[model samples]
Target chain A: MTKLIRLRFMFAIFCLFVSHNSQAQTKEFYLTLENHVFTPSELKIPANKKVKLIIFNKDKVAEEFDSFDLNREKVLFPKRKSTIFIGPLKPGNYEYFGEYYPNSARGVIIVEVNYVN
Target chain B: MLINTVILFIKDLLPIFVLLCLVSTCITPNRVPHEKLVYVCFSSVVGIFAKFYYLPMMGELFDGMGIEVIKTLELVLVYFCLLIGCSSLLTQNMIAAHQSNLTIVGLVIFTVINASEFIIFLDSYLANSQSIRDVVAGLSIGLGICLSFSALLYFSLHWFIKKEFFTLLYVVWALFLSGQISQVVNLLQQVDIIKSSGALWDSTKLVKDSSEYGHLLKTLFGYEAGPSLEFIMLYTASLLLFIVTFFIKSSKKQHYDIDRV
Candidate 1:
């Protein structure tokens, strides 16, 4: 009976730690597009960790989010929200551009170890 | 604006011109019959119309995977048709009459892809009307470049064919096809449709893919600054498959000829 109670206590502590770790790990970032330009031309993110990116197209025209570095491309319709998951990446810079507006719309992601924490 | 527009025009149209030049050189005559040409043109127009009308619907299909999936399918189909058309020429083991139709199918699919870009560019320009003149001038220049470059390709390929450099032509053709096949891998990776093991090497500093020469090389042979392991493997595999199949078919034909003799 004593052993069973000890095991339950340990399990409860383990669950709490896991929940806290998950909450600490996921980071959210936002980007906005307007007039064929990214609001933040560059974004900084933590290396070796998955990130949730939410992009808002504030423009009247659609834009394609293309990153040859990250190997990701998605169409962002006008006045729509796009959610993308990026990384667990190595520390480096990943450049992206708006395929439709390659010249004016460009940005980079600078990934560094422990940049956020 | 004019320069930018011109560059964009060439960038968008060059693929079409290159494909046409290569395909035309693969066969004997430089021109197809008028009726067949009209049919192919009509099909391309239909493709453009279909793309414009269905863009929104296609975007939302398959939970936002519709476009990638559809484009990948179209590209794969085009590659196969090209393989059949070109391989038949090299091996002479298939019905020559049907080869023309296969090449036409490849042409139509490629036109659809290339024309969609034009449609997209036009729509963008129409949305912002200030750059109309720049766009028009740029398009004209782009057309000029395309025509000249394609003519160069046509003449060179013809010269090679005339010289009976079948081996050289076959090797180049195999590499070109492999490059195209590699693009299917790229597209699949782009949309997260497939995962790559990451880049194997970075050659961007040595040869940036966006440079003029880089673009030319890319079109002629799928060149990438940083290529993934999957890409290298796929390119080699596809090239080997084409070369081996060509030789196998040719040997079979020779054996048949010997028996008849």
Candidate 2:
């Protein structure tokens, strides 16, 4: 009877830990759009999760979200939030730049994944 | 434990190991390095050309001219080139003295590894899709070509008696490592060697051959450029992983005094 109770307590602890981990490892994000130069100059995602980027175009003119690093391209209208899906990726840093304003729409997705050596 | 792991790994690649044995049975190490070098050069040109130019043309010609047999033949040749790539790239320092057919084994394994990469890496892109079936079908069909190419390479490299498989494999691997395959594939696709249904275009994921590290990825292992961040990240890790595998294999060879002994 005591052993059974101990097992139950352990199971409860495991469940709690799993639940906490799920919540704790919330998908982190860092997104920015350059107004003077490109649309989204910088983008970041947690490595290997389905990345949903909501890039807001703050510039007056239409801008394209482009990056060699991320392999995504989209047109972001001024004052509109556009989303680009990026991941479930392996770990590595990639560089992306705005195609419309190559001079300005530059950013990097510093995908920091755990235990990726 | 170590011995078991080694045995299991060999068992896993039993097919290539047997093929290597069979190849060595009918041959002895040749004394003609000069002739082998020429073939290596030939392997490089032929392999690279086949990968870049011939593949897409065959794909297009199959579609346009409806010559399925020719297309199949071309795919076979691509595999041959893959074997050739591996054969050529191996320096003399990585083989066991008892290993008379190191070239063939290396090339086949290399092609297998190459084919595996094409299969495994695409999963990262497909896993997240709402429609798993569609992503699977797309990835399979595209990568099926790679498998066919690798298998064909296995056959051609193994069966070709006069041709040293290692030299050929080395050259082809070099060309492949140069990132020329993707560019050639891209250019060929642009010219309609293979036509995308453009259904994949619907996905925002970009698999271009011309991104920053795109060429690097491509040359190393046929990684397409402009892939979604997911694809890029996965590919980079994979590339690193493969490089590590190569290094490990080399170190193991060194430990055994396989070549220098």
Best-performing candidate as measured by TM-score:
1
Residue B213 of model 2, lDDT score: 44
- Candidate 1 structure quality by residue, lDDT tens digits, A11-73: 986453221324245688899999999979989999877676778989887777878677666
Candidate 1 residue-wise lDDT, B103-159, digit = tens: 789889978976786676567666878888877887888889889999998899889
For model 2 chain B, where is the 10-residue window of minimal lDDT? B195-204
For all candidates in order, state the fraction of native interface contacts they contain: 0.02, 0.00
Off by over 4 Å in 2: A1-30, A37-44, A115-117, B1-208, B211-223, B226-261
Quote model 1's TM-score.
0.85
Model 1 score (lDDT): 0.75
Candidate 2, residue A114: how far the Cα is off, in Å: 4.0
TM-score for each prediction?
0.85, 0.27
Each prediction's DockQ? 0.08, 0.03
Best by lDDT: 1
Worst 10 residues of 2 chain A by lDDT: A16-25
Candidate 2 docks with a DockQ of 0.03
Model 1 alpha-carbon miss at residue A18, Å: 29
Q: Model 2 - which docking category?
A: incorrect
